[model samples]
Target chain A: MSLTAANIAAKPKPAATEGNGCQRFNTMPGNGAQPKTNYCASCAAHDKALCSRLTGSDLAEFGSMSQHKTITAGQMLFSEYDDARYYYTVISGDVRLSRMLDDGRRQITGFKSTGDFIGLGTDGHFTADAEAINEVVVCQFTVPTLNQSLEEYSVVQGRLMEMMQEEVINLQNHMLLLGRKTPMEKIANFLVERAKKYSGVDLDGDAITEVDVKLPMSRTDVADFLGLTIETVSRTITKLRKNGVIALETAQHIVIKDIEELELIANGEA
Target chain B: MSLTAANIAAKPKPAATEGNGCQRFNTMPGNGAQPKTNYCASCAAHDKALCSRLTGSDLAEFGSMSQHKTITAGQMLFSEYDDARYYYTVISGDVRLSRMLDDGRRQITGFKSTGDFIGLGTDGHFTADAEAINEVVVCQFTVPTLNQSLEEYSVVQGRLMEMMQEEVINLQNHMLLLGRKTPMEKIANFLVERAKKYSGVDLDGDAITEVDVKLPMSRTDVADFLGLTIETVSRTITKLRKNGVIALETAQHIVIKDIEELELIANGEA
Candidate 1:
């Protein structure tokens, strides 16, 4: 059976346990404590997100139309075939976008983090399922509201187009990774890519032996994303650690000991 | 070692022969033909392409900015790392968008046909290489020209955004096919998808015993696109034919004898 939101809600909630290696958190309703004035203008992701192009009255207008939403780990933001009524901009945390076959085999298409936009579907229904990987806060806008605003703000429209173009590029890169890369290369590429997401870090800090990399998603999620088994994922990580390419700070954190080496491996040159 | 435009140009041009199972045609220079008025409005792809939304003066302006060119099968339309100067809309034939690793491993990300847009790059450089699968005709426009047109025509801008969103959806579907689907399922899905591309075909004609489907791309291109080896692709096609699901009219044409059976195989239910 398909894992719809209603199906998930109907099922008995699993215990909030860490033993299974799958992280879980309880869903909470909105607190309604957010600031009313110029929310988009003051957003932390404003400069980096599609909203950054908006200014003055346009930015304020977007803020008025947007609602802040928080989703706990394991809570689905939307499911396949869900009505495409909302557009989302990730404020914080990661959201895993996946699709499942009839037999329940899943493929994680993407992991959206800060400043990433979601729910830009052509058809009225979502083609994939999106679930919160951790505590995720997003600025949500109703489709009609966003489309009206886009009509008024050319800059906002341009930014949205640019964002979509970037999404296409990202998807193409991931396609290559999925279609051609080896398992070791996939892991290395994933790590390097995840590192790049955390911009402003000293990526070329040769003196620094290890740089801590946060991995909010579990190994299973990583495996699904990379089209590998969980055992393969674990084994590859362990092999990288043994080779001094990476170090495990925790189950959810990795330390890149050799960025150059990882790059070489990712490019299949090592 | 990279297959850059320079490398392609440096290599000796293959003879324009069809006997090799690949059609090679010479790249023709742009010619200022007759009937300059109402170019976009009178375009054959106007109803199908993004230009359909444009009207009157906007259409005329766009037509003035676009140049039509034909590229042979072996010609490179654009290469990875090339400057993103022009945007193209395929008027006829197919183009393969691909990326290659430094070690020469290639991944076919997409195959664009009639009315499909190309070169919507996020950065100033193209992320993938585009080559004509056969003799192809395309309408090309400079990036600045298209951006200027988009600013003037909101309909054009909206259409572009819609196209990008559709591209994201397509990429997600392909990701599932690459990462999750079995080899047989992949081939089945590919055939079904290719059949759908041919508009006006009797896709569901219960009375029709078989329907012809054209495949402009070679088996090797198909294998690369589906993440399978050529031998595996051949074997899978043979199996489908032996099962009475399809018949090969030629290496490039497939006749679907049982659409229901193909659908079942595509869904992994058969």
Candidate 2:
């Protein structure tokens, strides 16, 4: 379906707190009746955030400057050309960062999951749109506050730099995938990466054997991320399954039956 | 041509000093006849590197940690799977950063020009190979020395973080181009970006007219960088020229005749 501001506005709005140092704007009136507190110590991403580098009062100070936000699936957290007021860190679920051409062609730049940082553009305006692929929770802080915290905490600044470098590396690898990898190779690489990122190890005796990977994004999203059509993505998955390299547990789950073989295909050795 | 380690090692080596607080390894035997000193203050990228943020003793200390080297065209600066011991910043000319699959498919991730930083991978091993597209000069520094300098100078750390963020942004834009843009749109975007980056404005009676953009990399390199075939790249350039949107002064240089129209095509609005 085509995305428009008016259509997006008609969806369910996120519920946020309005008073006691936390102010939230509801996209739909009376939608945010269930108020929530913006506490960082109890946050899921607290350990992965820059605030984790802080100690005692410093952590409390950072918590006071941050807010917790929950956005529903298909809801846009922000759009292209919007003024970037707050930096974000994903706490749960998935967020798709994308840019759409005027003719409606969309490129998914990234699928940000737990612990991934967002909205750190150098320019005042965002160059891409960010939407929730599932129910997503994020920690938000103003740019000024983030900068002040960075100046006050060197470790925090160092961590932020490290994350940005990680982002550069991730994007570079994606470029290789989109520019060179064949359809099957792209699918293999995607599965391998997802398994490494979000898989649970299944131990057979003292040695680890397999992993269970959950894919939150749809096949269409995968096609967009891999720079292929939906038909190509589906065909490749069927071929891999036929080749006995992978097993489908459900629509949004996969089991890497032959990981070594998958790795060979991913590296283009097969 | 297929790139192999032996072929790359057979190219002309980069000249470097062997002793006197600097050690440089020659990639090929009997290839370096000229030796050079490690002088950061007199370097061309002095105002662009991380050392530019240093002052007085800090500047001198950073200078002691950096080495300047000139690499000839077609020579590999560093290859994939090599140890990423040093970070580099281009002082002059262009460098191509690319990765090749085991089956020989290669993708050019970026073309690093003057003031662009390279070799900032997080893992110990380099993920892509960097080669000098032309005779190029670069400033190199070890990671340990860079970290020590960061400890001594917060501004240097901040500046490094900013550059990394810029790299992330650049790669994200390229992701959109590779994944979504049509061939015409891709070429249009590439030209517009290059013009903005390297163009010199010619003013006719203060009215501000045409822009002169230099294309240092070859057509094949541009094709690989844009994820298109060489034939498609050449044909698109010819089409643009015939359409009166751009004029070719030489094979390696272009004048954006109608930048406004080019911008519209780049955004896919035309």
Candidate 3:
């Protein structure tokens, strides 16, 4: 959420205003792994963000400034009103975006898996808290560089706008899902959507066709996400397994052996 | 909600499979609001939408083919998979964006005030249902006009993208609000936000510096929106009034005596 002078070029005239474009943004290279300031560990050529339309030198230019950073679970990447510094792309593990109440009860607003973008609020201070769900690897870009890139390339800007809009739509749908959806419907939809995102079980090899996505958060977190209680999440998952709508390969892993059936269940067919 | 054919000349088209650079789309007006159209009452005007954004000669040209349609409270303006024939704009009243569970549980995704856009989903099929909260009026547009308008104006496209992104942010925030915030915080914040939207209130020709917003939804609907039980909502309101954070003039009218105190409460001040 913020970048420091250590991460960015030092300006002699660092005139008092917190760099709205780039302030206190820093990255933690994976422990004991050689750090490459040029390319992030998880965000190298293998990054899913590379799947975007940017190609050739444009992609390289992007990757160059997208420095590698790391965060452990519960570590605050940035909170509301931190100077806006860098935009992030998750490379490995999960990132949880959340907001808090004064009494300390916090609702995890969103979870960023690999390939998801983390921060993109407007010119104001950060709106939500971005925290890592687990040890996460990410690529951070300074605000000024990002703005220059966005202004220079219309395609990039358009794509960025579209992605932002898409994130918003996803968030809205999740609100409905959390606020009103039944437990079974929530679990079903989560499974299908996660399966779509996680893809390939890596069973025999990378070529494995099917997938079983693990629930990263516990029942409590899932409940928070779905606006239900932990008891409800447990009961519903149990019900799903019993009904053969989904299989519990382990406490964490959910084997969505049938996507179509999962979809049916999510649509309230069950 | 959409205008019905015979009663109106516009047709709604599905957003599914809609690709870019859409210059060839025909704006020819048709008749009637189809049951299948995703008529979001909120999305009344899009900078790129033809029927809603038309002006001067353009308005006159399109008006000849348009018709006025009214929907009664609690009736569906459109449902999922409705063939897109006409686009709609709410002339009056409010609508709810919702999806249902087969067993009858309902999730209200969003509420549309005047000038809000509705019915836009990926597949040209409405992802949810639109229901009138009261008597509602809509003007319809053919899909061709919408696509044509998008192709012609880049600025409009930019504005459309910005609006969509804002909607997304609202949803994401709502997810946090519903999933994490407590009952009192939810209602207080909801009221505060609505007051901001309505701006100021008039009382007996004297200006009320602080305004109280009447919640448009029933307790049951409010429960769904806040992810709480109706009892919780009722109890929370009582507690708030007792705390002197707010005063209830009637069952529907809420007068905020101290907005700063309300904000403090919303932020978890004791």
For candidate 3, lDDT tens digit of each residue in A1-270?
111112222212121232222222233434545434323334443444522556666665565666666677767777765665767777788877766666766676777877777665433345677766778777677777775666555555545544554465466578767776667888888777777667644332444434678877677667766767789889988987887767888878887666677777777775
User: Second chain of candidate 3: TM-score?
Assistant: 0.72
- Worst lDDT run of 10 residues, candidate 1 chain A, spans A1-10
lDDT at residue B212 of model 2 (Cα atoms):
76
Give the TM-score (vs. native) of candidate 1.
Answer: 0.86
* Whole-model lDDT, model 1: 0.76
Best by lDDT: 1
| Top DockQ hit | 2
Could you give candidate 2's per-residue lDDT for residues A36-119 as a string of tens digits? 222445557767665656656666676667776788899888877665567888988899999787787888988888878896
The order by descending lDDT is 1, 2, 3
* Model 3, CA-based lDDT: 0.61
- Measure candidate 2: CA RMSD: 9.3
Write the residue-wise lDDT of candidate 1 on B1-270 in tens digits: 001121111212232211122221112223457334445565666776868777776677677777777788978887776666778898888999998888978889999988899976446667788999999888887777787777777667667766766778789889988988989999999988887677357676666546678888888899889988889999999999998899999988899887777888897788
- My TM-score estimates for the predictions, one after another, are 0.86, 0.81, 0.68
TM-score between candidate 3 and the true structure: 0.68
| Model 3 CAPRI quality | acceptable
- Label model 1 with its docking quality class: acceptable
